[model samples]
Target chain A: MATVEYRNITKRFESFEVMRDLSLSIADGEFAVLLGASGCGKTTLLRMTAGLETVTAGDLLIDGLRVNEVPPRDRDIAMVFQNYALYPTMTVAENIAFSLEIRRVPKAERRRRAEEAAALVGLGEHLARYPRELSGGQRQRVAMARAMVREAKVFLFDEPLSNLDAKLRAQMRFEIRQLHDRLGTTTIYVTHDQIEAMTMADKIVLMRGGTIEQVGTPDELYDRPVSRFAADFIGSPAMNFVEGTVEANGNAPAFVAEGIHLALPVSLTVAPGSPVVCGIRPPDLVLNADGSIEGRLVLAEKTGPDVQLHLSVAGQDFIATASRDAAVEAGGLVRLSVAPDKLHLFDPQSGRRL
Target chain B: MTVHSASRRRLRIVAAWSVVALFVFPLYYWITTAFKNARDIFDQPPSVWAFDPTLKNFEEVFGISLGFLRQQEVLPGGGNFYMAPRLWDSIVVAFGSTVLSVTLATLAAYALSRFPFRGRHAFVAWVLSTRMMPPVAVAIPLFFIYKDVGLLDTYAGVILIHAVMNLPLAVLLMKSFFDDVPKEIDESAIIDGASRWLIFRRVVLPMAKGGIAATAVLCFIFSWTEFVFVLTLTQTGLKTVPVVSSSFVTSTGTAWGNMAALGVAAMVPAFVFILLVQKQLVRGLTLGSLKQ
Candidate 1:
């Protein structure tokens, strides 16, 4: 396993800078995920590490060695492309054994290792099948097997499960985590899906507009996001945001918006009369009889285990999740309270967390 | 409803057959004329079915007069009707040029498909523009060059020119085939520790087999039928079928039967080549329509 470091890396496409002065250090054997929306430079970052794209400025180091000019073959890294990229003409065993064959491994040993890799992916029976003959999930497994058999110092995955169906995507996500756990190979996986990052990453590097917005554990990102974008991106049903002014109410801070006044944590400090955006996760909002905030429920959707409430509060839309057993109705007035600690405060002008 | 649909299907079949027959009519007439005597060929109102078929034309064109058969009277120029060596020359030049052109085009095309060099579009346009020059215009300059190089009537000279003539079309066709292959495959191969050429040979080339076969067939057919360069550059040392067929038009009159005989014989090699690659040709034609 190897640690990958990008020191002040910047990528520009003919003056249109895609990644700007980005620095990240991935620990050896760490499953680091580069997570962001499309055009956020997450894939570009992964491709840089894979040696498919050149770093326009600064240095890229693998295991503390400067590898700026190293070709992909010399980088000792294996990549699983989004399309699975299996050689269409090669059978599953041959595909898995390609790296070994390139190294001029003995035929008997190549076959043995290929079968072992295939069995690791639960594809032992598919050894003789070509990629075109396999289904999407099977082809994905073949690509994984191909990467695994290389036993490289680093593994790069470029949105590898994005093409699979929802059910298959979840299954493969879990399998990938399990594979990483077993191998402990340094991996950098790029994806726009927050759930995959949350469930699989040891550290999630959230990116926006070609720069790092937050790099932390999933819980840290969800609980203490550095920016409003991070707060909005991490949680399902999305975090609710209310534009308001922070005011002093007998030393305890209060967030006041149109037709609403919510108490802030006593220890929280912000300048009085300063505009800020307050964020609260869906599950943290509780419905109580004597809650401080009142809103008219606009829609209620029961998604299996939870009922999602879309409420209109102070002329702004907010979402809150409750148990499936919760009795909520559309067009009904409801009182909601947020736990003070769960509330996130951000500067209104810059969207930076305060 | 059943009767109406069945009749509609029958009508479609008839229309398809009529179209195919329309195309095959000229070839049928040409082949039949190769076996007819001069009297039968110019019969009043034309004899479409009934004719005294003869092998005299073939015997003259092939320089083979069969034993135990009454030999037909030869033309005034007697031995000039013998064209077997010219037929051999056509086969050699076609096969040689096809092999040469396909190899060069495939390599050039793979580079064009993968590499992002400056002015790549302009380079491709320049390569294609070489073909825009009219054959007559190119043949005169080529004749002088061939004479200077002492390649005036050599097989190598003809093959080289034909290969050069076919390069533009071959390269364009092969490049499209390479483009149909996803670039990810090459990247994946690179990450697997294979070099650029290894990835091309083992992965990209195998996938583009159908396209290569199709390109080779087209090159072969074009070389087989080329006329201008062969006529302008060569003497009697070597002659292709298209140029040699003109020799039949002596000072007296055009020897139509002998020319038709040569034309009919020339079609066999090209037809056999197409038949051999017919499966790949169909597949290559529709290659880019489906995503792998």
Candidate 2:
């Protein structure tokens, strides 16, 4: 229900800084996700927004009002922690109503709001049960319900679904997305899982080593990552990077590595002798009988829907994902081709996309 | 059915029983001795069980004189002369000391646990070192100071000494207990619009009930049976149960019967104190460290 802005925010623990000169704005009602690996300051940024942590030097605005000195209780924000943090002693109903009780809402209204939120999280029957009695997924629902009942201006989720098993994580991911759509609250979620960021965020903020790397929509980041780090981090099986030199071949451009050459897209503008790293996503590399690039399959793994093949060209390793029906044997020679536009080129030294 | 397997099972059972007897025998001896008459205590082969049980020992203990006999009574240079029994006096001193010490120590422990302040670690180390010092070493200086302040033979003097003696242990134990509670629970309350004090009252304190109970029990045990300080500082009137029991041994005769009864009375509180906390003691001690 409110926009959040971080202007030149920095956090330090003693002499070591965790977040430095970080500035980003989340529009009102936007599902923005701060994505990064552990200790990359994503959760630190989220906690600062929730007023659970102090910003070393900056302005944190909620609804355009600075909240640097505001305590968490007065910040009018709700946070769902990774561990749920549901009061072990309280029943589901009490947990959900805790905020309302703190705000001194009437008992009847508290009960009504708690029931409504419980129904939203699909925990209507679990109102009387304590957190310990609930399953992991149910405990998570109770945590969600607790946040929902507050109806605060901002919703901060610090890797809320990371604690669940794979199946539960996927299911809760959908539920969270649906809940966001329904509530339309200005939410800032922090997670290290790029897949979660891709599936859930309207805008993703990629961070590395206490600074923002790139911020964009999921498709924008996947289609054109600004750096090698982004390209490598935002995909499953990760993007394959091959170090090579760009060479002009009869008006066409090609990347030349040791004992190997890959023809670049016709639109590539890199001059000859330019040191570059070419990135190819696993799924984009197709396995065809008449494909241009040939390599021996080093390993093949059948993972239900797709079979992943680890192919070696000369001395370099490459991964190719094919349909489950494809019959590929380890150590067998196979040709792999990728769409021209799907290839990403980066400057070797700086790692910036070229 | 196998010989090796049977012997192995027997060995395991014997080991378990040995552990049980190791802890249980001392308590059993104390309980049996509390009931024995004077003759049975010194029988050729000391009786394990009381042949003639009597409450006479208890009666004799309650009736015993506990006043200090002044060495220079009616001195040439005049001074007040007095001989008094201080059983009731010790009870007052111990109770007063335990309450005052534990209350202050608990508050100190809470602050050390919850807040981050300047020199917090150094302060904790300093308090812990105070406990490491032998009670006898501190008793010498404390005795002179209390005497100078006109606190000789006063209940307050003994109580104050006991409180200082027990405070460090109480503080250290409580700090560990408070640390065991997860900080996430506190943050959850904080984000819910509850103030810091409210969080402590409704969330932290309730969760720490078991811990506080455990600390109180430990503090009470230390304060109740402290003997050295009470013996040195208090010459008359203000005597603890341990100090009263010590008086029973003299050159004239050792009143084993009276001593045993008084010893049993002192042990009763310590026993009951542990029993009260025994429910939470196991959980509080482990604090779920064994759980994955």
lDDT of 1 by residue, A143-206 (tens): 9999999999999999998888999999999999999999999999999999999999999999
Interface RMSD of 1: 3.6
Candidate 1 - chain A - TM: 0.99
Q: What is the DockQ of the complex in model 1?
A: 0.49
Q: How good is model 2 by TM-score?
A: 0.91
Off by over 4 Å in 2: B1-11, B64-96, B147-156, B284-292
Which residue pairs in candidate 1 collide? none
RMSD of 2: 5.2
What does candidate 2's lDDT look like per residue over A123-219, in tens digits?
9998998777788889888888899999999999999988889999999999999999999999999999999999999999999999999999999
Candidate 1 lDDT: 0.90
Top candidate, metric DockQ: 1
How much is the lDDT of residue A47 in candidate 2? 88
DockQ of 2: 0.33
